[model samples]
Target: MAGTDAAPADSATTGPVDRAAWVALAGCLLGLFMQMLDTTIVNIALPDLTTDLRASTSEQLLVLSVYTLAFACTLLTAATLGGRLGRRRVFVTAILAFTVSSLLCGVSQGPVELIVFRGAQGVSAALMSAQTLALIAALFPKARHGLVFGIYGAVAGLAAMLGPVVGGVLVTSDVLGWGWRTIFFVNFPLGVIACGLAWRRLPQLREQPPPRLDLRGMALSTAGLFFLLYPLAVGREQGWPPRLWVMMGASAVLLVLFVVLERRLLARGGAPLLRMDLFGSRRFTVGLSLSLLFFSVFAAFFFTVSISAQFGLGYSPLRTGLLALPFAVGGVLGSVLSPGVVDRIGSARTLCAGALVLGAGLAWVGLTLQPISGTMSIPAVIAPLVVGGIGTGLFVAPLQTAILSDTSEANIGSASGCVPTVQQIGASIGLAVVSLFFFGQVATQAHSAVPATRAELVADLQNTAVEPLFRAPMADRFADCARNQLTSAHPDRPAPGCDGDPSAQSGMAADLIGKANGQLQEAGRAVAARSFVGAFQTTLWALAAMCAAIAVLTLALGSRPGPNKPE
Candidate 1:
């Protein structure tokens, strides 16, 4: 989910190659591109959907969390299914599912319906994700594996960078007045083309019979993940009620049951989806934890920044996307240049450098936002973003490599499946947790901000020469009314106040009321902006500290996985 975290180190045993192989690679990577593209594209549409659908902040969080939760829950199952059914057969089927789900998403009328469809799309994406590596393993001989993987990584990086821009264009243009719907509809053509190419070009390997799926394990895992994620996603928004706490406890118990069952099953000579032994190695544990921590922070970064740009500052979707472009560019360049850096100084150094750079960039952005109380210009956002992105490219690619480098080849399938799950879980948790902090800050700041804002407006008004002539008492009364109006459910629409009072129907009184309302709106906007600035700065600094922790962790990473290879 966080680019390249779950990439399979499938060192394929291959003998031959042809044009078919290249085409197959193209088709597989296209699927990869589409999958990654949706991840970023969805973020761009969040603010739009929030405004248009009258969605609560909680519901908006659900829109993002459901997809990731579903994807994480299904990765291991989907990976095994692809192996059992044959990767190409499963891959094409997933494309069909993804296409249909995209349709369902585009036409969705409400947040719940849209969230459900997004989960379906996530399930489909999980299926397709497994095949990206599987197809490459099946089609390309060992000789061309690196080349294909390079292409694959490039496509993923490009998609991540391009998603915002594309979403912005579609949303801004409101193609056919589709508004945010165009973002999903755009997936239709890509899914169709990818499906066609996959069906025709990908090889049909005679897959050996796969082991039986652990249905019980799947059930427990699904329920467990759901229980854990649901509470986190909604709890803060709901003020962390007792029911959620009970659910969290159930989630823990269910997951503990899963681990117990998996261990027992492994001892009994039955297959378990995840091998517990994989975590026995210190290096594997440390590296994967570090990777998970890094990814969570990475994912939370975009969500927070997107809200800051679109909701806080009132930037158009297109402009927000453009603001994110430099980050993506740096990400691509970092991915491109990282391999050389790794080859020279080793992965540990590369990871440390990346984490440090990312932390610094985030800190820089936080500093810039602090002065403005979270309000920012395009240049102010982009300059640091470029640095942060390069850090992302540097950190992400190498982190995946280092984490996988710690595990054995036999574990690659499980590791690949687990990697994304961890990344997604980290991302999902980070987003939910950070949103709690962010909104809490916003609410607290806004509470005090409202009165202060009104006072400032009144102070300014008192000093004006014409303030007394404009029915000063009426001005003060309307100002109080306007403050209440500013806090209405629908802030954009004009609301009834003194103007609606029959007793205040005098033309002079109406004019005074209109002036007060206009003044109040301006004051409200300024307060909202500053509150966002404070909240965003707080969240950003917290994330930077997280990054710095990861940087410190790199120093403790044991030598690569080979020294403690699995038995």
Candidate 2:
């Protein structure tokens, strides 16, 4: 909207103090907070949800992933509808629908019911999210764009980072005895308030002589995105089955066909769900690619850190959540400072600086972790987390500004939809790739620990009454059991042949046997912690490399236009 003509009916000349405009922006940010919060909040509550509903592994995956799938698939269509009907109208409707769906999720008694409700919530979230940028552009004048977008970025980033924190607090506190259901139930009041504010303050800014809906384009794009995102979401957990690859291939074909169809429609002077000319601008194209690369690091870094902190370090959910606080604080600081930086240097240089700072922070984090010590000092990592957070704040909002800098009024909605869709897909793909690397490293490290475990096992059995011949065999079995347990998919469950203590089988004295078993458990935990630490360190290095790559990519971005100058 910064580069586009203002709607004739709208008061484009309004300043930041215009109460209606600021209020409307507040409502949009609230909706955005809800949408981003959902992307990760339910994750921390999964263990409770699984037990409550008796969900299987596949069902658990679906419960977590279906929301993203639905949101990604519907974004393009929702954006188009918002432009044709009305941004405010569609946004308010989405808020009401999202509120209802969240309530339904809270009351769901079965896994299937919850999954279905989550999908509905996702669709509503897409409708709300797709209209946010367009609405912001329409409500605020171009002069205030940087400040407004910085605030928007700060809210969006903070919400995402705080999801686990909030989820952990709710699950631990068990307010109203709601347990995991509190996560969904909490959304009810927020949605109601957002809806009321938006409905009252948001003005209708429909496209004049509204374009006809391109039903075929919508269908193709939806199917294409669904096929592409679904496998990326679940394929790793499912072992990258051949069927998933086939789905990805089909997605490519469908998307290519969709593009072809849209081009032809535009040539014939028909309405297209997406405008092809948006990509013709080098800034939009490069900026979109940068968004994808940056987001890939964004979600993957959190996922790896969450697993490492909770499982590897034996941290409670609340502790894990608290660990991210430094990062959030840093992000807020960065967000607050970014607009001023942009004004001084420009968006491209600011993005480069952010990427470099983030990469350096990540590298510091990786170097600080010592797998040999088998322990992580939380205090040591806090500084790097804060630094990384600041970098995130600096990059995210400005990246959005850079991408849409050249988008025309007619294509703003489409551009908005494309940015988020690419980001979500990038996140999904990053998670899949990082999971493979992380788990594979875990397995390798687990197996490598066997010899040391065998040595410790033999030492423990040395003074026992167990026969010498049986001692070697018992040590071998114990080592194998430890490896198997550490590498198992469900590490919480005992691996086969690992349930009974080896000391009990050796017929030692009761006290000695208990002592030996305790030692064995300690050794097993050490192996796991070390394995996870090593894997986490490797992941951090990879993410840092990605950050460096993002910085390099920023070199290709066009410079931001000066005040009152043409882009």
Query: What is the clash count for each candidate, in the order shown?
Result: 2, 0
- Misplaced by over 4 Å in model 2 are 1-17, 457-472, 485-515, 564-567
Candidate 2 lDDT = 0.82
Q: Give the per-residue lDDT digits (tens) of candidate 2, residues 1-567.
A: 222223423424544447877877888999999999899888888888999999998999999899999998999999989888888888999999999999999999999999999999999999998889888877776666667777887898888888888888888889989999999988999998898777757756677678899999999999999999998888877878899999999999999999999999988988788889899988899988988888889888888888887777777777777777888888888898888788778889889999988888888898889886567888899999999999998888687788877876778888878877887888787887888778777777776666766786688687666667667776777777777876766444468857756444554534444645665566666766787888888889989999999999998996658454422
What TM-score goes with each of the models? 0.84, 0.93
Local distance difference test, each candidate: 0.71, 0.82
Residue-wise lDDT of candidate 1 within 443-560, one digit each (tens)? 6556656556656767656544435655445445644554444344323223475234434666765555455555645655566676667777888889989988998898776554
Model 1: CA > 4 A from native: 1-22, 46-61, 109-113, 134-158, 200-207, 370-374, 406-409, 443-452, 459-513, 561-567
Model 2 Cα shift for residue 392 (angstroms): 0.5
Question: Candidate 1 clashing pairs?
Answer: 373-533, 374-533
